[model samples]
Target: MIKSIGTDLVKLERIKEIGIEKFAERILSPKESVVFKTITNELRKLTFLAGRFAAKEALFKCFKKGDLTANYKDFEILNDENGAPYIESKYTKELISHITITHTEEFAIAFIVLEYAEYK
Candidate 1:
């Protein structure tokens, strides 16, 4: 069952001026490291990191039961074999049902569906 949906858009140019590597270091996971490594443009890097930040916040909002301020490092979004993003957390895996993520040049969006499943 689809519990909730959230989406966000970020300005590509805004991130560029700030430096992409800094933004990537702050947001992107170890798996996403490669994505930024090859992206030469600073703005594209910022756009990517901004999108990821938004995706993490969106997933947190959709979580069934938890304090909004709770530290959730495990909740960081990671790319799958196909480059699709998914939440990786022992807590979320047990509480969440499923999720989907998408992005464009100007924005990145993520939808989280809460569910009851065994934690892998």
Candidate 2:
């Protein structure tokens, strides 16, 4: 069953001015940072960071107040063998989360749908 839906948009130019390095440290999980570091292209890295930031922001909107207290690092966005993005959140392991991310040259946007099993 669906519990909540959340979406966020971020401007790439704002992230560029802020510097991906600074925001990456603030927003990315350790595992995510490692992956971010592997991208050699600066534009790709910036887009990646923006998408992740928007993703986490969207994920944050999925919860009710007091559902949990979480920082950006607690939400790890990862890919499957098929390269489909997913949210890996230890705090919400019992709940299913679907994520989609996309970017234009100027902006990055992400959406998340939080779902629950019948048990929840």
What's the number of clashes in each of the models? 2, 0
For residues 18-79, what per-residue lDDT tens digits would candidate 1 score against the true structure?
66777667666676777668888755666567767777767667653456454434456766
Instruction: Output the lDDT of residue 82, model 1.
Output: 88
Q: lDDT (CA) for every model shown?
A: 0.63, 0.89
What TM-score fits each model? 0.65, 0.93
**CA-RMSD of model 1:** 3.7
The candidate that achieves the highest TM-score relative to the unseen native structure: 2
* Residue pairs of candidate 1 with colliding backbone atoms: 96-115, 97-115
Model 2 alpha-carbon drift over 4 Å, by segment:
none
For model 2, residues 1-120, the per-residue Cα lDDT tens digits are 898899999999998888779989889999998899899999999999999999998988888563676889999998889988998877678887889999999999999988886645
Lowest lDDT sum, 10 consecutive residues, model 2, at 60-69
TM-score of 2: 0.93
